[model samples]
Target: MSRWPNLKQLHYLVALAECENFNRAAKACFVSQSTLSTGIQNLEELLGVQLIERDNKSFIMTPIGLEVVQRARQLLSETKDLLEMTASRGGSLSGPLRLGCIPTIAPFLLSPLVTLCGETYPDLDLLLREDTSDNLLKLLEAGELDLLLLALPYDLGSFHSRVVGQDPFRLVLHEKLIDSYEANPARYAGLPDHSLFLLEREHCLTDHALSACQLADQAKINPFAATSLYTLVQMVSHQQGATFLPEMALRAGILERTELVAVAPQGQMPHRDIGLVWRPSSCRVEAFAGLGRLVTSCLR
Candidate 1:
């Protein structure tokens, strides 16, 4: 059986499963499409099983292929941990580190942190991928990322983390809405169930903001969705409707050069804690711990 499948073949298979396209998977694996295809074919021949079903328009994984991909991920992750453990004996942390952060946090916080990582560890080739939390966590589980920056108190099970920072939610209101809410700030909490504009679904910020204001049960989140924070800010500036903004976005001048302003919601303000998380099984625990502390410093 050709000594079973090799790590390189396993990597290609996993990449294809995740990307679902040859061109994209090849690009991610840093190989030509033909090379990735050949690797996968060799693995299939060795295993005597068809892993992928090729079609004229789409690629799909067989059921067994799905199961094998999961195991391949674990094998690759363990191998990486073993290598990192060996490297740790020499007191070196330099390597290609893949990191992922959500869209909301990426624009407001990642730029300075990227520079800091470069300056602090010149040998570390840090790769950053901005995506939704779901995608980032999926990548993390697949061992595609060494660590991730994400907001907390959601359902990230079993993954260990270091709380790096917190972002408070600001009650962003239009100039005209100020008089409506300033006289009775509590009234803003009762905003018409349908008046609040929000980011599309699966954005943790949307959920966090809604929960922070205690609106999860009743607030009528508008069907008019925003693709980015700037869109929400501009909507508010034009007096479209009111919504919440994170402290980091405010600090980044999201409302700058506009009439839009933020007021702290009355009572205990709503906030989300940001953290750097990694799989506990990772061999880079020491490096991740050091990186976590460094991340907090850069964030500030």
Candidate 2:
């Protein structure tokens, strides 16, 4: 018979590998530094390999140790999925669901989604995290988030996704900026790249809008980037410049009682497909699909 290191020890090693500091890893594992040290010792004794190179100044995982850490992460993620699957059974939308959403969509989507879950899936505890899509996707890959609510045409690695809604883009400007944005094609063409603003970098919305407008060479992006659509709306109010906004935000009273005017793009509308995404290996794929349907149904 051969002895094996426990899952908890693997967890400790993963934490150490990520943090690269014994003290920080111990804190993350919620154990004493000496306890974490002993766990690693046990693991090395069992595996007959020095997983980490120890030093007073720094710690480095060996090449094989790095591979083990990667596998450990995958193992922990699968274990979590199994536990969540077991909990999801025998209940109608019961148990916790950690969902991540991009900042642009959070304000418009989260409130109603929360209410809908409360009304329909009373047993479900929906935990929400608002962040950039890149950040959210990282969390999703790490198994920190079960699903993501965001706009698509994004690279989601191996995750599977379902379209829940579409948000068309429109050019938003102050009523005073242009006389009338009617059927005049010149007005659209004469749009100054310098007068245009965006929602800052790393926001997929900004990228989508830029691509749709063919404004790659337009260098007039605002020096100070707007953090939220509301901020952009305020800037438009002050006659700072015209910007692009999604149809959902505009429909949600974003332009209400404000002087900003939202007009559909001159020709074919530039729209983003909103989606719900999760790992295909997740046991809750069907469950998440149903949840996705539930979410989009409310949008109708």
Candidate 3:
């Protein structure tokens, strides 16, 4: 018979990897430091590999330790899903569901989504996290997040996703700028060069906007990038430059206090698809789909 590391040992490894301190990891796992340390030793002994590099002074996770932590996370997530699957087999989706959303969409959708989820699934505990798309996706992949609600056309990378709604991009600019463009439409010609302000490139919203609006020329983009939609709005409010804002934000009254104008582009309306994404191994696909339908309703 072959020996294998137990779930408890793996959990300790993950906690240790994250905490980087034995005392902290032990506290996180609700065990004594010696107990957690022994469990890690046992795991390494069973596997016949040094998972952590140790010294008299300090310690660091070996390269293999980091890789093991990643796998341990996945295994733990799978085990959790398996238990949840069994528990939810004969009942409604009822558990703590950790959901992640990108920053741009979170402000506009989180309130309504929470309200709707509370009304629809009273038994379900919906946890929310808002971060950049890249960060959220990383969390989701690590099993720290159960699902994601974000703008689509993102590379989900083996995750299953369903586009639930379309969030069209509207050209937003100062009232004076739009008035000038309207007065001389030919001179403006869609978007003038050196006039489009965008969120920093780290945000997927920036890429989505650029792709949707076909703004490929670097000359069209202002060198001064914004860190958030609020910053972008503030920049445009000061007559800095034009920008593309999602319609949901406009509907949520992002421009209520300001005198900015949000209008459709000249030809077809450019848009980003709003989607729900989850790991393929998730057992709550139908529940997520139902949630997706609710999201679509909120879009209306």
Cα lDDT computed for each candidate against the true fold: 0.81, 0.82, 0.85
Instruction: Identify the superior model by lDDT, candidate 2 or candidate 3.
Output: 3
30 Cα displacement, candidate 2 (Å): 2.5
| TM-scores of all candidate predictions against the true structure | 0.85, 0.89, 0.93
- Candidate 1, backbone clash total: 1
How do the residues 1-300 of candidate 3 rate in per-residue lDDT, one tens digit apiece?
298789999999999988889989999999999999999999999988899988875689988888999999999988877777777772355778888998899999889988988999888899999898888888887778888998889888999999999998988887767766676555245456778788998889988887887665677678888998988999888854688899999989898788788766543678999999988888878778878888999998
lDDT of 2: 0.82
Instruction: Please give, for residues 1-300, the per-residue lDDT of candidate 1 as tens digits.
Output: 438789999999989987889999999999999999999999999999999899887878999999999999999987876776676642455877788998889998888787887888888778899998888888888777878999886678888888877788888876667776677546665455566788887788988887777765345566787889998888766754688888889888888898877887654868988898888787777787777777778656
Question: Once superposed on the true structure, which residue ranges of model 1 sit more than 4 Å away at CA?
Answer: 16-42, 48-61, 88-93, 189-193, 216-220
Residue 211 lDDT in candidate 2: 72
Per-model RMSD to reference:
3.2, 2.5, 1.9
Clashing pairs in 1: 193-220
